[model samples]
Target: MTKEIFDDIFGKGNSNWQKVSFLRRCFFNDNGITVNWRANTPLIKLWKQAKDLDEFKVLLKKDKDAQKLQFTHEWLKTADKDYDQYLASIIKETATMQYDVWSDAGSVKVGNAQFSFLISHNNGDGHAIAAVFKNEKDFISSPMKFITSVEGTFNIYDYDCGQNVIVTLNGRYDVYVYCGITCFVKK
Candidate 1:
């Protein structure tokens, strides 16, 4: 029975026997209070919280934990892209020697770059072309592996001019010569 009903039944008189007990009426009671209570109050108090600038400053002390990098590869890919762009910029700096139009016999001396390339008619041996990319393994070098002869993809690891190609990061500035196969890059 509720305290109100009990009090109504037996008036609020200090008649000892009429002093009703305030026992737990609700099932989930802490102290005669409902345990399964739900308040309409929201979690965020819009404007009621007191702002303490000084106390906040005191509490917001500098963090002691080092700012460790989390999964640096995510941004590392960005760095890779940046380095790739830088390498591409350097490749552009040297200017591509792509000036092939049709199978013909000729040699080109790249301006101020000390690079030499030739396309010659092997008479009957299909084709025989070679380029002397000096000090230029970045563009062409000595591990000079060929990825594909048909596609004209090639790689070199050393330089005749003692220059380092694919330095710092590998496969940055890819160099290939589509010999005697007219692969001209229009500026």
Candidate 2:
């Protein structure tokens, strides 16, 4: 419910969470396969006008020689060190693919989601969170109605927090999410 986990915002119109929570955290810039961060200032434009995943990848890979490329270490070489990691981290998050069904590992789907998470007790034993919505699955199943599946991580929350997440998908035209402590665990 807290978007403060990674200091990244989590709410309507937010898209970065889907990438990392669904796939892996190590994202790429030149392509969305590694991450899909939208620069505070927009970056290179994707060609082919892809709306779907496959098309987006083709678009993301296009026009490689157009601008300066960045890497984790390379970006750090510049004046700002922290910002470089932050930028690269967001990029790496974009590379992950989306899917459904919860698998033990090696898959993008979390059933709900399984974005790679890291936890810290520096604040307290109780966990803190910061999540991002990645995708949604709608159908006529027992679950019924809208089923949104997001992909975000808790760099500061408990590693188990993602598992305990009890998600309730709200029906809305555009992307919608409800966050907050629905319940607390006494551990």
Candidate 3:
């Protein structure tokens, strides 16, 4: 009877029966039979292999270059909605930037100010910078440029400098200021 239900749900032989395991034992009583079975499908197998959500996230990040697998309609019917939503959000955030050439690393918002971080690669080297914006047409501070390196490692930190917001970029090379530069603001 359990096999019949499994076959009906998984379309008979679609899943590996040898790998399928039971989560609970079948009990018989006047109330009839109760069996708890877990199907070790590729999706379920991946979920079980992860120790926790953070580990799952790391796995997803590492798998970004590989082909993505999604839940089937049948699985979605019984899958955890919270887990599904969490996966969707992770995919959305990670999909926002590409790593090869240029990317928007991320942004931080402090009160009414916003700091945007960007990374650009050129001639086999990469540089990262932070741009501060006050409203849409003004600049609170000059763009802060970090060190350049072949690895393109960069990070941004925000702090309050007197009454103004200061964004600092940490990278591989020595820091220098490029002031009095012609800047263009795109609407």
Candidate 4:
């Protein structure tokens, strides 16, 4: 029994005895409690939200581990307050090229802060991570990779950017693209 029930029946003097007998009670005295003990509480919510078992498993796995990705084509999608765009110039530049690097990214911005994530498939891909700053040089056509954790999320900090400036993800050596999402909050 739980401590609450045990205490009510035998009084507080039985507390130590309850602890001493916990293993035996768990093993043979209570079948219902034993069965529920190993149950995962989050799985119930996951099952409710999921369309099927396969989708449920996918959601569980995404939570349990980071996924790997590969990029073979390059494109850019960007957004600010007034407009969002697919940069045609970058799309044209990467059209004739092929990128074969293992890469992954998923970023979300909240309020004035943006959380970034990226991962290189391996070290052989000839690229380095750099932050996409507000003011970039003339020949720098894309945002370079920035520092990230091993699992790919960036270390949280105040990101520097201008209100009207455009920031986009780019690979140093090859073509790559990822899904971009934006959410807004009222000041």
Error of 4 at 117 (Å): 23
Please provide, for model 1 over 52-156, each residue's C-alpha lDDT reduced to its tens digit, 9 standing for 90 to 100. Answer: 323222222211110111111122222243422332333334333322122223322121123324323222223322232223432411112332222132222
Query: Which parts of model 4 are misplaced by more than 4 Å?
Result: 1-40, 57-121, 128-187
Candidate 4 lDDT, 26-140, residue by residue in tens: 3222432343423444433444466753564455434321111100011111112211122223322323322222212232211223543333322322322222322222112
Backbone clashes (count) for model 2 = 24
Model 1, TM vs. native: 0.17
Please report, in order, the local distance difference test score of every candidate based on alpha carbons: 0.26, 0.27, 0.29, 0.28
Output the better candidate (1/3) by TM-score. Answer: 3
lDDT by residue (1-187, candidate 2, tens digit) is 1123222422223476563332223223433333344333112233223344344333333333311233222322332434323333332343122112122321211223434432221223232222233332211011112223323322212233345433323222221211111111111
TM-score of each: 0.17, 0.18, 0.20, 0.17
Query: Which candidate has the top score in lDDT?
Result: 3
Best of the candidates, TM-score: 3
Q: In model 4, what lDDT does residue 123 have? A: 31
- Measured by C-alpha RMSD in angstroms, how accurate is candidate 1? 29.0
Give per-residue CA lDDT, model 3, range 57-87, as digits (tens). Answer: 4454345321133222123323434443443
Worst 10 residues of 2 by lDDT: 178-187
Where is the poorest 10-residue window by lDDT in model 1? 62-71
